[model samples]
Target: MSTLSADLAHQPGPETVAEGLLTMLAVVPVCLLVAGYGRGVQELWARRGAGQIVPPWRVAAFGVGVLTVLAAEQGPAHELAESSFAGHMTQHMLFLLVAGPLLAAGGAGLPLTLAAPVPLRRLLARWRVTPAVRRLRRPTTYALLAGGGQSIVLWFWHLPEPYTAAVDHPVTHTAEHLCFLAAAWSFWAPVLGPPRHRAPAPVAVLALVGTMLPASALGAVLTLAPAPVYPARVFGADPLADQQLAGLLMWAPMDLVVLVVTLTVFLRWLRQLDRDRPAGLPRTATLPGTAAVPASAATEGERR
Candidate 1:
C-alpha cells in the first residue's frame, strides 16, 4: 500500500493550487452577478404585482460544474497528472463527461448574459449572428462540430508527440486542457440546451453515440498495443501497467458515462412526449390498480 501510494502521490505545486483558487474566484463574481441581478429583477417584477422565484437547480448545477473543473485542473489530479496516468485520466473524465454537461444543463452562458450590462448584453446578442457563430446555430452542424472536434482533440493529443508535449510543457498542457473543455462544452450544449422548435433529443443521442464510439475505439487500440504509446512514463510505476490502466480508464468509464447520459436523455425525451400528449386520454392507458396497457388494447378491453 505504501509503495502504491508513493507511486501515485506527488508534491502538489503552489502554482497549481493558486491556479485553482483563481479559477474559483473567477466564477464567483459571475455567479454573484447573476444571483444579485436576478433577485433585483424579481423585485422589480414584484413592484409591478408579478414575480417568480429563480430556479435553484440551474444555479446549483452550474456551481457543481465549476467545482468539477476546479477539481480536475487545480486539485490533486492536476498535481499528480504529470507523474501518473491515472491522475491524468481522472482529470479528463471529470472535464469531458461531467463538468461540460453540467455547465450546459445549468445554462452557464445565460447567467453571464443576464448579468452583463444592458449595452454589453445587446452587443453580445448581436455578435451571435456573425457568419462563424451562425454556422454553429444549426443543430446538425453543432452536433458534428461538437462530436467531431472532441474526437479529434482527444485522439490527437494522445499521440506521442502531443501527449509528451502536454506532460512536459506548461503552455501545451494548459492548451490541451482548454481544448478538451471547449470540445466538451460544445458537445454537451446541444444535448443540454436544445432549440425549442426542434426535437433535439435524437440529435443529442446521435452526438453522444458519435463521441462514445471514437473514444472507446481509441482506448481499445491503446490497450491492445503491446507498448506504451505515450512517452509520458514519468513515475516509477510499471509503464505497461500505467498505460493499460489509462486505456481501461478510458474504455470502461467513458462508456459508462455515455450510457448514463444516454439514459438520462432518453428519459427526458419520454417525458417530453408525455408533455406533448393531449389531455383527453393517456396514450398508454391504465385502469385503476392495473398494469399499463397500449391504448388500442385498453380501449378494446373497455369495449368488451
Candidate 2:
C-alpha cells in the first residue's frame, strides 16, 4: 500500500505531463457544449422573457455529468486505476453509468444546436432531413443500433488483447474512454433525451432491459472465470480476486441501476395510462409530446 501511494505521489514525469495535457485537450468538446448550452439558455430567456428554458434539474445534471467525466479522467480515480483492476472498473462505471445518463438527461442537444453558428445550425437542419440521417434516427433503428454498438464496444474493450493495448498506449487509452462515453451517451439518449426526442416510457424500459442482460452476462463471465483474464501486473494484490471484484462491481450495481430505471419507467407509463384513461377504455403508453393525441395516433408516432 505504501509503495502504491509512493508511486502515485511521485512528481509527474514528462510523459505523464504530456498525457495530462492531451487529456485536457480531449475534454474540450464537452466543455464547449456545456458553455454553448448555457449561452443558448441565456439567449432564450432574453428573447422570450421566460423563466428557465431548461429545467433546473437538467442543468444540474449537465454540470454534474461534466464533473464526473473530468473526475474519472483526471482525479484520484485515474491515479488509482493505474494499479488496480477494480479501480479501473470504477472509472469506467463513472463514465458509462454515472456520466452518460446524466448528460443524456441534461437536454443539452437542443440547446447546443440552438447555440451553434447560424450556418452550422442551418447545415445541420438540412443534413437531418437527408435520407440516410432520417433512417438512422428512426426510433426502432436508432435504439437497436445504439444499443448494439454499446454492447459491442464494451465487450471488445474487455477482451484481453484490446484491453492490454489500451492500457499500454496513451492514445488507445483515450480512444477507449471516448468510445465508452460516446456509446453510453448514444445508448441512453433515446430514454433520457429532450422530451421531443425521448422514446415512450415503455420503449425506454425495453431498451434498458435489453442492455442489462448483456452487461450482466459479461460480469458473470468475469466473476466466474477460474483464472485472471487480465495481466497480473495491471492489478493490485491478488489479480484474480481483483478481477472478481471488478466483475461484481460491473454486475451488481449495473443490474440494480438498470432494474431501478426500468421499474421507474414502467411505473411512469402506468401512471400516464391511468391519468389519460377514459372510464371504460384501454390505452397504450403515449410519447412525451403526443399525450393529447389519441392512443392510436401516438402508437405509430415513433414510426412517423
TM-score for all models, in order of appearance: 0.73, 0.85
True-vs-predicted CA distance for residue 170, candidate 2, Å? 1.1
Per-residue error for 161 in candidate 1, Å, reads 0.9
Clashing pairs in 2: none
lDDT for each candidate structure: 0.75, 0.86
Tens digits of per-residue lDDT for model 1 on 20-42?
66566656754674475455545
- Model 2 segments beyond 4 Å from truth? 1-14, 50-53, 280-304
Cα lDDT for residue 302, candidate 1: 77
Model 1: per-residue Cα lDDT at residue 233: 59
User: Highest TM-score among the candidates is held by which one?
Assistant: 2
